[model samples]
Target: MFIDTHCHLNHERLRDDLQGCLERALAADVRKMIVVGYDGPSSEEALRLSLAHPGILYAAIGIHPHDATTWNDAIAARFRELARMDAVVAIGEIGLDFYRDLSPREQQYRAFEEQLRLAKELDLPVIIHCREAYEETLSVLAAHPLPGVMHCWGGTPEQAQRAASLGLALGFGGTLTFPSAQNVRDSAMCIAPEHLLLETDAPYLAPAPYRGRRNEPAFTRIVAEKLAGLRCLDLDQVASITTQNAYRLFPKLALPP
Candidate 1:
C-alpha cells in the first residue's frame, strides 16, 4: 500500500512508455501516484494521463514558481477550469524556489500568492515545492492557510516543525538515501509520523541505487525502504502510514478496488 504523493508521469520518458511504466509501478506495489504539473501545458498533460489511467494515476495542476512569469487572470481562469476535473486533486507543485530563481522574485511572489488564493477559493489542498525559500514559502502560507504536503521537503527539523505548525506534512524523497541527506533525515526524524508523506518526484530524484539514472514510480519502494530504516519501522508500517497520510491529505485519491 504505497503512494507516490508526487511524480511526473507526464514527463517524456514515462509518457512515451506509459503502460509499461504503470505495470512496473504496480509490480513494485505502488498503489497510487500523483502526476504533478509545473506549467499549464504540463498540467493539461497530467490531467490527460490521469483521466486515461483513472484511479491509479491522479493529477495536481498548477504553474510552478519557475514558470510564474506565465501568471495572469486569463491563465488563472483556465487553471480554475482544470481544477474542476475529477482527477485533479490539488493545486500544486507550487511555491518558492530561490535556489534556481528561474523567475523574477517579485513575479514568483505574485504567482505564489495568486495560486494560493486559487487553492483557498477552490478548497483544494496544496503541493508545495520549496527549495532554499522555506521562510518565504511560510510567509505565503501564513497569509493563505490551506492544508497540504511540502513536496520534496528539504528543510531542517525546526523548519519541519514550523511546517507542521502550519498544518503541512513533510514530503520525504530519494534524497533520504543520499549520504549527505542527513539534514533531510534529521528533519524526517523530528517530524511526527502523522506529518510524514512519501514521494518520489519521479523522473527526477531516484533513490541511491538508481541515483543519476532516470527515476520511475517503481523506485518509490526504495524511498519507503530508506524511510523505514530512518524511522526504525518495518517496510509495511512505513507504507501503511504514508499511504494513510496521503489519502487524508488528498481525499480525492480514488481507493483501489
Candidate 2:
C-alpha cells in the first residue's frame, strides 16, 4: 500500500473530478491520501471530504504562508474551531515561504508562529511548508515543543540534520526524482529512514515519467522508486518502510490492509 501524505485535493485541478482522481490513485495502489487545507474554505472542504470518505481520506487544517496576507484574529479563531474536529488530523500546510513573498516577511512569521502555537495548544502534529526560509522556520519551531513534518523538503544536509535533531520528519516528493535535484537526493540518502516520509504535494510535483503533467497520489510510486534507488534498497523495502514512517507521523490514519 502507498500513502500520499501531502496533497491538496480541494485545489481546482482535482476538485472537479475528485472521485476520478481518487479512483486513479487507488488503481495505482495509492491506498490513502491526506487532503491538506491552506485556508478556511479549503479546510472545511477537506474535513467534509474526510467525513464523506471515512477511512480512505483524512484532513489537515491550517493557513498557508501564501494566505498570510489575509490572516487575522477571526481566521485564527476559525482555524482553532476546525482543528477541534475529529476528522482534522493536523494544523498545517503552514510555515514561511520567502520564495514568493506573497505575504510580508513579518506577517509570514506572525502567521507561522500563531499556527504553531495553535498546534501546540491542540496537542497535534503540524504539516509545515517551508521554502527559502529554512533558518527562520527552524528558529520558529525551536521556540516551541511541536511535532511536525517539513513538507517538500529542499534544504542542505546540514539543515536536514537540524530538522531531524529537533524531532521533525522530512517529507520527500517528486523533486527527488529530478536529475538536477542533487541536493534533495543527497539529503534523502542521508536522512534516517525512520524520520523520512513520502509525499507527492500533488496536482503539483509529479515524479519522472509524469513530470510536467498533472500530478496525483498515484505518482507516488515514482517517488518510492527514486528513494529505493538512492538508498540502494529494494522497492518493496522502500515502500514498506516509508508507509510505516507515514503511519507513525500521522497516527490518525486508518492504514489499509
Give per-residue lDDT, candidate 2, residue 123: 83
lDDT tens readout by residue for model 2, 1-257: 88888998888898888889889889878888889999888888999898888777889988899998777888888877877766778888899999999889898988889888888888879999999999989998999768889999999988998899999999999999888889898889887888788899989988888889988888887898888988999988987898888777777784441
- Candidate lDDT scores, in order, read 0.89, 0.87
Worst lDDT run of 10 residues, candidate 2, spans 248-257
Q: When superposed on Cα atoms, how far off is each prediction in RMSD?
A: 1.2, 1.7
TM-score of 2: 0.95
* Candidate 1 lDDT, 111-149, residue by residue in tens: 988898999999889999999999988878877888899
